[model samples]
Target: MRARRTPEPYLWLLFSGGGVVAALLLPVLVLIFGVLAPLGVIEPPPAARVRALLDPLLVRLALAAVVGLCLFHAAHRIRFTVEEMTRGGRLDVVLAPLCYGAALTGTVIAVLVLF
Candidate 1:
Protein backbone atom coordinates (compact mmCIF):
# COMPACT_ATOMS: atom_id res chain seq x y z
CA MET A 1 0.00 0.00 0.00
CA ARG A 2 1.21 3.49 -0.85
CA ALA A 3 0.86 5.26 2.44
CA ARG A 4 1.89 8.61 1.04
CA ARG A 5 -0.82 8.97 -1.55
CA THR A 6 -3.77 8.15 0.68
CA PRO A 7 -2.81 10.59 3.38
CA GLU A 8 -0.67 13.19 1.70
CA PRO A 9 -2.49 16.29 2.85
CA TYR A 10 -3.06 15.11 6.37
CA LEU A 11 0.53 14.06 6.74
CA TRP A 12 1.78 17.41 5.57
CA LEU A 13 -0.56 19.19 7.93
CA LEU A 14 0.64 17.09 10.83
CA PHE A 15 4.25 17.61 9.78
CA SER A 16 3.86 21.36 9.79
CA GLY A 17 1.96 21.42 13.04
CA GLY A 18 4.48 19.16 14.67
CA GLY A 19 7.36 21.34 13.54
CA VAL A 20 5.71 24.39 15.07
CA VAL A 21 4.92 22.61 18.31
CA ALA A 22 8.42 21.15 18.61
CA ALA A 23 10.05 24.45 17.84
CA LEU A 24 8.08 26.19 20.52
CA LEU A 25 8.11 23.54 23.22
CA LEU A 26 11.43 21.71 22.87
CA PRO A 27 13.70 24.60 23.76
CA VAL A 28 11.65 25.52 26.78
CA LEU A 29 11.55 21.91 27.90
CA VAL A 30 15.30 21.62 27.54
CA LEU A 31 15.92 24.89 29.31
CA ILE A 32 13.82 23.84 32.23
CA PHE A 33 14.71 20.15 32.53
CA GLY A 34 18.20 20.10 31.03
CA VAL A 35 19.68 23.40 32.09
CA LEU A 36 17.96 25.33 34.84
CA ALA A 37 16.80 22.32 36.78
CA PRO A 38 20.26 20.85 36.76
CA LEU A 39 22.05 24.10 37.47
CA GLY A 40 19.83 24.86 40.47
CA VAL A 41 18.41 27.95 38.84
CA ILE A 42 15.01 26.32 39.17
CA GLU A 43 14.66 23.61 41.72
CA PRO A 44 13.40 20.31 40.49
CA PRO A 45 10.11 19.63 42.14
CA PRO A 46 9.42 16.56 44.21
CA ALA A 47 7.79 13.56 42.56
CA ALA A 48 4.54 14.39 44.33
CA ARG A 49 4.67 17.94 43.12
CA VAL A 50 5.29 16.75 39.56
CA ARG A 51 2.39 14.39 39.91
CA ALA A 52 0.19 17.21 41.14
CA LEU A 53 1.12 19.34 38.15
CA LEU A 54 0.17 16.52 35.81
CA ASP A 55 -3.02 15.63 37.65
CA PRO A 56 -5.28 17.76 35.49
CA LEU A 57 -7.02 16.25 32.49
CA LEU A 58 -6.47 19.33 30.34
CA VAL A 59 -2.75 19.34 31.02
CA ARG A 60 -2.45 15.67 30.19
CA LEU A 61 -4.32 16.13 26.93
CA ALA A 62 -2.20 19.10 25.91
CA LEU A 63 1.00 17.21 26.67
CA ALA A 64 -0.25 14.25 24.66
CA ALA A 65 -1.01 16.50 21.72
CA VAL A 66 2.43 18.06 21.90
CA VAL A 67 4.14 14.70 22.04
CA GLY A 68 2.03 13.27 19.20
CA LEU A 69 2.60 16.26 16.95
CA CYS A 70 6.33 16.30 17.60
CA LEU A 71 6.56 12.63 16.80
CA PHE A 72 4.74 13.22 13.53
CA HIS A 73 7.14 15.99 12.66
CA ALA A 74 10.17 13.80 13.27
CA ALA A 75 8.68 10.94 11.27
CA HIS A 76 7.97 13.22 8.33
CA ARG A 77 11.51 14.55 8.33
CA ILE A 78 13.14 11.15 8.64
CA ARG A 79 10.96 9.59 5.95
CA PHE A 80 11.75 12.29 3.43
CA THR A 81 15.39 12.42 4.31
CA VAL A 82 15.78 8.71 3.72
CA GLU A 83 13.95 8.87 0.42
CA GLU A 84 16.03 11.83 -0.72
CA MET A 85 19.30 10.22 0.25
CA THR A 86 18.42 7.05 -1.71
CA ARG A 87 17.72 9.17 -4.81
CA GLY A 88 14.38 7.53 -5.38
CA GLY A 89 10.82 7.90 -4.23
CA ARG A 90 10.43 4.13 -4.18
CA LEU A 91 10.99 3.88 -0.45
CA ASP A 92 7.98 6.01 0.35
CA VAL A 93 5.90 2.88 0.68
CA VAL A 94 7.96 1.36 3.46
CA LEU A 95 9.17 4.62 4.92
CA ALA A 96 5.75 6.18 5.42
CA PRO A 97 4.38 3.34 7.50
CA LEU A 98 7.61 2.69 9.33
CA CYS A 99 7.90 6.34 10.24
CA TYR A 100 4.29 7.29 10.85
CA GLY A 101 3.45 3.98 12.46
CA ALA A 102 6.20 4.57 14.97
CA ALA A 103 4.87 8.05 15.56
CA LEU A 104 1.36 6.70 16.03
CA THR A 105 2.66 4.08 18.39
CA GLY A 106 4.53 6.67 20.39
CA THR A 107 1.48 8.88 20.50
CA VAL A 108 -0.61 5.99 21.73
CA ILE A 109 1.98 5.32 24.40
CA ALA A 110 2.02 8.95 25.44
CA VAL A 111 -1.75 8.93 25.74
CA LEU A 112 -1.67 5.71 27.71
CA VAL A 113 1.02 6.91 30.05
CA LEU A 114 -0.40 10.38 30.53
CA PHE A 115 -3.99 9.37 31.02
Candidate 2:
Protein backbone atom coordinates (compact mmCIF):
# COMPACT_ATOMS: atom_id res chain seq x y z
CA MET A 1 0.00 0.00 0.00
CA ARG A 2 1.24 3.47 -0.85
CA ALA A 3 1.07 6.30 1.67
CA ARG A 4 -1.25 9.16 0.82
CA ARG A 5 -0.20 12.76 1.18
CA THR A 6 -2.55 15.69 1.62
CA PRO A 7 -1.39 19.11 0.57
CA GLU A 8 -1.40 21.81 3.20
CA PRO A 9 -4.47 24.01 3.21
CA TYR A 10 -2.58 26.58 5.30
CA LEU A 11 -0.79 27.83 2.22
CA TRP A 12 -4.03 29.00 0.67
CA LEU A 13 -5.14 30.31 4.02
CA LEU A 14 -2.02 32.40 4.40
CA PHE A 15 -2.30 33.73 0.90
CA SER A 16 -5.90 34.72 1.50
CA GLY A 17 -4.99 36.31 4.80
CA GLY A 18 -2.16 38.34 3.32
CA GLY A 19 -4.21 39.37 0.30
CA VAL A 20 -7.09 40.60 2.42
CA VAL A 21 -4.73 42.45 4.73
CA ALA A 22 -3.02 44.16 1.84
CA ALA A 23 -6.31 45.00 0.13
CA LEU A 24 -7.68 46.64 3.22
CA LEU A 25 -4.49 48.38 4.24
CA LEU A 26 -3.63 49.78 0.82
CA PRO A 27 -6.85 51.73 0.22
CA VAL A 28 -7.10 52.93 3.79
CA LEU A 29 -3.49 54.04 3.74
CA VAL A 30 -4.07 55.87 0.47
CA LEU A 31 -7.22 57.57 1.62
CA ILE A 32 -5.62 58.67 4.84
CA PHE A 33 -2.31 59.74 3.38
CA GLY A 34 -3.41 60.95 -0.04
CA VAL A 35 -6.79 62.48 0.69
CA LEU A 36 -7.10 63.18 4.39
CA ALA A 37 -3.53 64.27 4.77
CA PRO A 38 -3.86 66.62 1.85
CA LEU A 39 -7.14 67.95 3.20
CA GLY A 40 -5.56 68.62 6.58
CA VAL A 41 -8.05 66.52 8.47
CA ILE A 42 -5.71 64.31 10.46
CA GLU A 43 -2.74 66.07 11.97
CA PRO A 44 0.23 64.53 13.72
CA PRO A 45 3.00 66.29 15.59
CA PRO A 46 4.61 67.11 12.28
CA ALA A 47 1.17 68.20 11.03
CA ALA A 48 0.77 66.12 7.90
CA ARG A 49 2.25 68.26 5.17
CA VAL A 50 0.51 68.55 1.84
CA ARG A 51 1.93 67.86 -1.61
CA ALA A 52 4.82 70.10 -0.69
CA LEU A 53 6.34 67.28 1.35
CA LEU A 54 6.28 64.70 -1.45
CA ASP A 55 9.12 63.93 -3.82
CA PRO A 56 9.02 62.31 -7.26
CA LEU A 57 10.91 59.25 -6.06
CA LEU A 58 8.54 58.67 -3.18
CA VAL A 59 5.54 58.97 -5.47
CA ARG A 60 6.94 56.56 -8.01
CA LEU A 61 7.87 54.04 -5.31
CA ALA A 62 4.38 54.19 -3.86
CA LEU A 63 2.85 53.70 -7.28
CA ALA A 64 5.06 50.72 -7.99
CA ALA A 65 4.22 49.00 -4.69
CA VAL A 66 0.48 49.48 -5.12
CA VAL A 67 0.50 48.45 -8.75
CA GLY A 68 2.67 45.41 -8.22
CA LEU A 69 0.64 44.02 -5.32
CA CYS A 70 -2.71 44.72 -6.98
CA LEU A 71 -1.63 43.18 -10.25
CA PHE A 72 -0.35 40.03 -8.56
CA HIS A 73 -3.46 39.63 -6.46
CA ALA A 74 -5.74 40.23 -9.43
CA ALA A 75 -3.88 37.72 -11.52
CA HIS A 76 -4.26 34.99 -8.93
CA ARG A 77 -7.96 35.72 -8.62
CA ILE A 78 -8.42 35.69 -12.38
CA ARG A 79 -6.62 32.40 -12.67
CA PHE A 80 -8.88 30.82 -10.09
CA THR A 81 -11.88 32.26 -11.89
CA VAL A 82 -10.78 30.83 -15.22
CA GLU A 83 -10.13 27.47 -13.66
CA GLU A 84 -13.56 27.34 -12.10
CA MET A 85 -15.31 28.40 -15.29
CA THR A 86 -13.53 25.99 -17.56
CA ARG A 87 -12.60 22.32 -17.62
CA GLY A 88 -9.04 22.72 -18.85
CA GLY A 89 -5.84 23.71 -17.06
CA ARG A 90 -4.01 25.24 -19.99
CA LEU A 91 -4.87 28.76 -18.93
CA ASP A 92 -2.82 28.47 -15.78
CA VAL A 93 0.37 28.62 -17.82
CA VAL A 94 -0.32 32.17 -18.95
CA LEU A 95 -1.84 33.68 -15.83
CA ALA A 96 1.43 34.73 -14.20
CA PRO A 97 2.86 36.40 -17.29
CA LEU A 98 -0.36 38.25 -18.04
CA CYS A 99 -0.50 39.64 -14.53
CA TYR A 100 3.15 40.67 -14.54
CA GLY A 101 2.68 42.36 -17.88
CA ALA A 102 -0.15 44.46 -16.51
CA ALA A 103 2.00 45.38 -13.53
CA LEU A 104 4.83 46.41 -15.85
CA THR A 105 2.48 48.56 -17.87
CA GLY A 106 1.34 50.33 -14.72
CA THR A 107 4.95 50.78 -13.57
CA VAL A 108 5.84 52.35 -16.90
CA ILE A 109 2.96 54.77 -16.62
CA ALA A 110 4.04 55.66 -13.10
CA VAL A 111 7.59 56.26 -14.26
CA LEU A 112 6.37 58.46 -17.06
CA VAL A 113 4.38 60.55 -14.62
CA LEU A 114 7.42 60.87 -12.40
CA PHE A 115 9.60 62.30 -15.19
Candidate 3:
Protein backbone atom coordinates (compact mmCIF):
# COMPACT_ATOMS: atom_id res chain seq x y z
CA MET A 1 0.00 0.00 0.00
CA ARG A 2 1.18 3.52 -0.81
CA ALA A 3 1.37 6.14 1.88
CA ARG A 4 -1.27 8.83 1.51
CA ARG A 5 -0.35 12.41 2.20
CA THR A 6 -2.82 14.91 3.59
CA PRO A 7 -2.79 18.69 3.48
CA GLU A 8 -4.13 18.95 6.99
CA PRO A 9 -0.73 19.57 8.60
CA TYR A 10 0.13 22.47 6.32
CA LEU A 11 -3.34 23.96 6.76
CA TRP A 12 -3.09 23.68 10.50
CA LEU A 13 0.33 25.36 10.44
CA LEU A 14 -1.08 28.30 8.56
CA PHE A 15 -3.99 28.44 10.94
CA SER A 16 -1.70 28.48 13.97
CA GLY A 17 0.65 31.06 12.47
CA GLY A 18 -2.23 33.29 11.56
CA GLY A 19 -3.71 32.92 15.02
CA VAL A 20 -0.45 34.01 16.61
CA VAL A 21 -0.05 37.02 14.33
CA ALA A 22 -3.63 38.09 14.90
CA ALA A 23 -3.40 37.63 18.65
CA LEU A 24 -0.21 39.59 19.08
CA LEU A 25 -0.66 42.41 16.58
CA LEU A 26 -4.35 42.82 15.82
CA PRO A 27 -5.38 43.98 19.30
CA VAL A 28 -2.66 46.64 19.48
CA LEU A 29 -3.43 47.83 15.95
CA VAL A 30 -7.13 48.02 16.70
CA LEU A 31 -6.54 49.83 19.93
CA ILE A 32 -4.31 52.37 18.26
CA PHE A 33 -6.16 52.99 14.99
CA GLY A 34 -9.69 51.82 15.67
CA VAL A 35 -10.22 53.20 19.12
CA LEU A 36 -7.72 55.66 20.56
CA ALA A 37 -6.95 57.56 17.40
CA PRO A 38 -10.52 57.66 16.21
CA LEU A 39 -11.76 58.70 19.65
CA GLY A 40 -9.14 61.45 19.83
CA VAL A 41 -7.59 59.98 22.93
CA ILE A 42 -4.39 59.88 20.95
CA GLU A 43 -3.38 62.14 18.13
CA PRO A 44 -3.36 60.42 14.82
CA PRO A 45 -0.23 60.71 12.76
CA PRO A 46 -0.32 63.09 9.84
CA ALA A 47 -1.01 61.59 6.44
CA ALA A 48 2.46 62.49 5.21
CA ARG A 49 4.05 60.87 8.23
CA VAL A 50 1.98 57.76 7.70
CA ARG A 51 2.97 57.64 4.07
CA ALA A 52 6.61 58.03 5.02
CA LEU A 53 6.34 55.21 7.50
CA LEU A 54 4.91 52.90 4.88
CA ASP A 55 7.48 53.90 2.31
CA PRO A 56 10.06 51.53 3.71
CA LEU A 57 10.22 48.12 2.07
CA LEU A 58 10.35 46.39 5.47
CA VAL A 59 7.26 48.18 6.67
CA ARG A 60 5.32 47.23 3.56
CA LEU A 61 6.34 43.58 3.91
CA ALA A 62 5.36 43.52 7.58
CA LEU A 63 1.97 45.02 6.83
CA ALA A 64 1.36 42.51 4.06
CA ALA A 65 2.27 39.58 6.28
CA VAL A 66 -0.03 40.78 9.03
CA VAL A 67 -2.96 41.31 6.68
CA GLY A 68 -2.41 38.05 4.80
CA LEU A 69 -2.04 35.92 7.92
CA CYS A 70 -5.11 37.46 9.50
CA LEU A 71 -7.14 36.65 6.43
CA PHE A 72 -5.94 33.07 6.48
CA HIS A 73 -6.82 32.82 10.14
CA ALA A 74 -10.34 34.01 9.43
CA ALA A 75 -10.69 31.59 6.53
CA HIS A 76 -9.55 28.64 8.61
CA ARG A 77 -11.98 29.44 11.39
CA ILE A 78 -14.88 29.93 9.00
CA ARG A 79 -14.06 26.72 7.15
CA PHE A 80 -14.19 24.62 10.30
CA THR A 81 -17.30 26.38 11.56
CA VAL A 82 -19.04 25.66 8.29
CA GLU A 83 -17.93 22.06 8.34
CA GLU A 84 -19.22 21.60 11.86
CA MET A 85 -22.51 23.27 11.05
CA THR A 86 -23.07 21.00 8.07
CA ARG A 87 -21.87 17.92 9.93
CA GLY A 88 -19.27 17.21 7.24
CA GLY A 89 -21.81 16.60 4.54
CA ARG A 90 -21.50 17.00 0.79
CA LEU A 91 -20.05 20.48 1.24
CA ASP A 92 -16.81 18.94 2.50
CA VAL A 93 -15.22 18.80 -0.92
CA VAL A 94 -15.89 22.41 -1.76
CA LEU A 95 -15.30 24.04 1.61
CA ALA A 96 -11.53 23.70 1.89
CA PRO A 97 -10.76 25.13 -1.53
CA LEU A 98 -13.33 27.85 -1.24
CA CYS A 99 -12.06 28.97 2.14
CA TYR A 100 -8.35 28.80 1.28
CA GLY A 101 -8.99 30.33 -2.12
CA ALA A 102 -10.58 33.35 -0.54
CA ALA A 103 -7.62 33.64 1.79
CA LEU A 104 -5.15 33.53 -1.10
CA THR A 105 -7.16 36.08 -3.04
CA GLY A 106 -7.21 38.41 -0.05
CA THR A 107 -3.47 37.91 0.47
CA VAL A 108 -2.76 38.84 -3.13
CA ILE A 109 -4.89 41.94 -2.86
CA ALA A 110 -3.19 42.91 0.35
CA VAL A 111 0.25 42.54 -1.23
CA LEU A 112 -0.74 44.58 -4.24
CA VAL A 113 -2.36 47.29 -2.19
CA LEU A 114 0.50 47.43 0.28
CA PHE A 115 3.14 47.61 -2.42
Best by TM-score: 3
Q: Please, what are the lDDT tens digits per residue for candidate 3 over residues 9-77?
A: 888888899999999998988998899999999999789988998999999999998888888889889
Kindly give the stretch of ten consecutive residues in candidate 3 with the minimal lDDT sum: 84-93
Query: Which has the better lDDT: candidate 1, or candidate 3?
Result: 1
Please state the error at residue 100 of candidate 2 in Å: 2.6
Residues 14-97, model 1: lDDT tens digits: 999999999989998999889999899988877899899899999999999999999999999999998999896998888889
Better of 1 and 3 by TM-score: 3
Model 3 residue 63 CA deviation (Å) reads: 1.3
Of 1 and 2, the candidate ahead on lDDT is 1
| Candidate no. 3 TM-score | 0.89
Q: Model 3 Cα displacement at 48 (Å)?
A: 1.1
Better of 1 and 2 by TM-score: 1
lDDT of 3 at 2: 85
**Candidate 2 global TM-score:** 0.49
Each prediction's RMSD to truth: 3.1, 7.2, 1.9
The list of candidate 2 runs beyond 4 A from truth reads 1-21, 29-53
lDDT tens digits, residues 2-89, model 2?
9677333533453465487577777887788788877888763253453444446676576566555565556556667776788647
